[model samples]
Target: RVKIYEAMEAVILGADELDMVINTGNACAGKWDAVRKEISDLVTATPDTVHKIIIETCYLRDEDIIKASIAAMEAGAEFIKTSSGFAPAGAVVGDVGMIKQATKGKIGLKAAGGIKTLSNVLSFVEAGATRIGTSSGTSIMKEVR
Candidate 1:
């Protein structure tokens, strides 16, 4: 499948980390096994690379977000990411807390998408984000300075 190929390609290109988005439709439909299998496959395809499973929190309910995070962790991913940065909304603080609870410190947490300010980054970190992904790191730094 394309997901597997992308994982393989990332590894081939010397990518140390791979961020793969999960199928939100499956998760929303309660097809947890399928979601788990997809992530598991990608993890298998790139054993040497760190895998971050993006759950796209904007489309999911609180419970769904927790379930997705758990599935990703059980599937052998190293991190559970909040968004792909293409959704209408991304990386909410409440969602970050839910993911942290679901993961139980078993995996890393990344909060991404629309994180543009130092306050945003700090709030996410306070809410248990292990990593912060943003396109405005420089601007955030400028705010700090």
Candidate 2:
């Protein structure tokens, strides 16, 4: 985690003009109040970093998911991601919608996890996901073309 922050700081400072910082960590699962607070502090400490809280939605209850979304947004997160793909449920359209609804357009939404095909990517995009994280980016685009 410290290493990630160090890298982020380096990238932010190395660039002549830094655009945004997307914090890709599962800070939204189970009891995340403490995690949320820590992430919030990180963002506050690094005012240049635009934190994007990645909530692994698989392990969280619906209420917890909502709470985490709210917490991330309140903590100054610029985006809320659906999953990290290391959990049971993974990313789904419904989960994307839930995060979208929870954030109320205040933050961007990223849908990730098992997105391997063009259709899958389109599904997420159609479902209001502003960003698509996938290892199959090349294949998906090739398939689309």
Candidate 3:
């Protein structure tokens, strides 16, 4: 039920956090005003919840990524995340580094997708990612041991 809930609707239903993808095409085309408005609308609705804006870093240029990160933050995102995990490639160290630098620690960064190893986790952390989103948690724990 949670996964199927539309972003703001989920927050209304008591979700503590909301991570939803916007129309990435708009964001990628430098259409920040509309994208910002959309994201802000959700943020306004979820004032009590942690709203994460997924920018799909794999699909944008560094400048575009930075712009998306700032727009999301300015619009009230608690975090700016890198992928929906449906892209051919997921979070990369360079993308994380750029986002970290762009946000300047004002908002948290979540590095998700294709993160299968401890080193991959550390790389993102070192780049200022505050959260790691991965399906390989158990394997990462095993690698730590």
Candidate 4:
């Protein structure tokens, strides 16, 4: 279950943004309402902070990804992220594009996980990712320079 009070505690502790992972189990079980409700509650709990919901696309089918993206947008998430970077794979261009279509530009898109190069970053951006999360920032910056 989503912990609304704990999320509020983070806000009270001075966190300005939150990146939350949706329950992939519920999503895989085809519980769209549960998925949406959890995200909505989190958003409602911390209205002052930016909410970025990680759908963990690597574990989902294309249809699930699309559905999840739409649900997050409707639930008031500011961004729908591709992964938490702990999956078997990270963000992919195709997934990002699919998520973009599902959200219809109403919400932001973030590409995370395994993004290690400037080329990777550029590809995701071209695919409609508005934000990028990576651990290779230093190397990626070197590529830019």
Candidate 5:
């Protein structure tokens, strides 16, 4: 973890084009407050890296989902992402709605986690996801085209 933070710091310091930070670990799943605080401190210390927090929705309840979303935004996260894709469940429309409601237009929402089909991607977009993360980006764009 320390190594990862150091590496992130290095990236932030070295890359002039670095514009965002995505936290892709499920280890920070239920500990929303702590995760938010840590990310806030990290970004504050850097002040240039934009933060995105990914909450593993598979292991979180609806309340936790809401809390995490709000906490991330309050902590200065630029985006609230759903799922790290390491657990049983992935991104779902309902969870996206919760995040949207929690953030209330303060931050962008990213829907990832097993999103392969165009219909799934559309569902997330319709539900207020501003970004899509997937290995099937090509296929999805083809469908859109």
Candidate 6:
């Protein structure tokens, strides 16, 4: 319901990708249905656009991360993203690894937030992250030595 409007609004504004936060609260509480529904809503709203569902791994347990990632993929998301950068923690190599393994070369994986180093970004890539998100773009780029 919420993501329906927001995703449509993003599409209207010409967003090439629709990245929406999963119902992290409900997801952590073990309510997989609500989380998957939210992702599904956005996917339906943006059929032709890329739908990235951010699982916000910082607040989730390892099991929850796997569940949420799988749910997002089952609900038709094109990408499973880790974190919104608003939480206390951000994307980790382990989390990315779990997500990558779950995706099984089916959907894309995006690692975002707290990714400040070249090695960190590269590690996520090696873990099969197709996209890297960070606020420290310049410093990360400077590591090209």
lDDT for each candidate structure:
0.93, 0.70, 0.86, 0.92, 0.73, 0.87
Report residue 93 deviation for candidate 5 (angstroms): 0.7
Candidate 2 global CA lDDT score: 0.70
Rate residue 126 of model 5 by lDDT. Answer: 90
**What TM-score do all the candidates reach, one by one?**
0.97, 0.77, 0.92, 0.96, 0.80, 0.93
Candidate 1 weakest lDDT stretch, 10 residues = 6-15
Error of 4 at 18 (Å): 0.5
lDDT per residue as tens, model 3, 7-122: 65666677898887766899877898988888888877667788888899888888889999999999998999899899888999988988888888999999998999999999
**Model 4 clash pairs?**
none
- Number of clashing residue pairs in every model? 0, 0, 0, 0, 0, 0
Q: Model 1: per-residue lDDT, tens digit, 1-145?
A: 9989977987898899999999999999999999999999999878988999999999998889989999999999999999999999988999998889878989999999999999999999999999999999899999998
Which regions of candidate 6 are displaced past 4 Å? none
- Write the residue-wise lDDT of candidate 6 on 1-145 in tens digits: 7668877888889998888888778987899998887777778778899888888898888899889989999999889889888888888998898888877858899899899999998999998899999898899888895
Model 2: CA > 4 A from native: 1-33
Per-residue C-alpha lDDT of model 4 across residues 43-118, encoded as one tens digit per residue: 8889878999999999999999999999999999999999998899999999999899877789999999999999
Q: Which tens-of-lDDT digit does each residue in 33-101 have in candidate 5? A: 566766676556555555567777777778877877777788776877786666677899989987897
Q: Give each prediction's root-mean-square deviation over alpha carbons.
A: 0.8, 4.3, 2.7, 1.0, 3.6, 1.3
For candidate 2, write residues 6-109 as lDDT tens digits: 64676577632212222324433355666666567666656655566767777666777777778888877777777766656567887887777887878888
| Top lDDT model | 1
Candidate 4 vs candidate 6: the TM-score winner is 4
Rank all candidate structures by their TM-score, best first, as comma-separated numbers: 1, 4, 6, 3, 5, 2
Clash pairs (backbone) in predicted model 6: none
Residue pairs clashing in model 5 are: none
Q: Pick the candidate with the highest TM-score.
A: 1
lDDT of candidate model 4 versus the reference: 0.92
Worst 10 residues of 6 by lDDT: 36-45
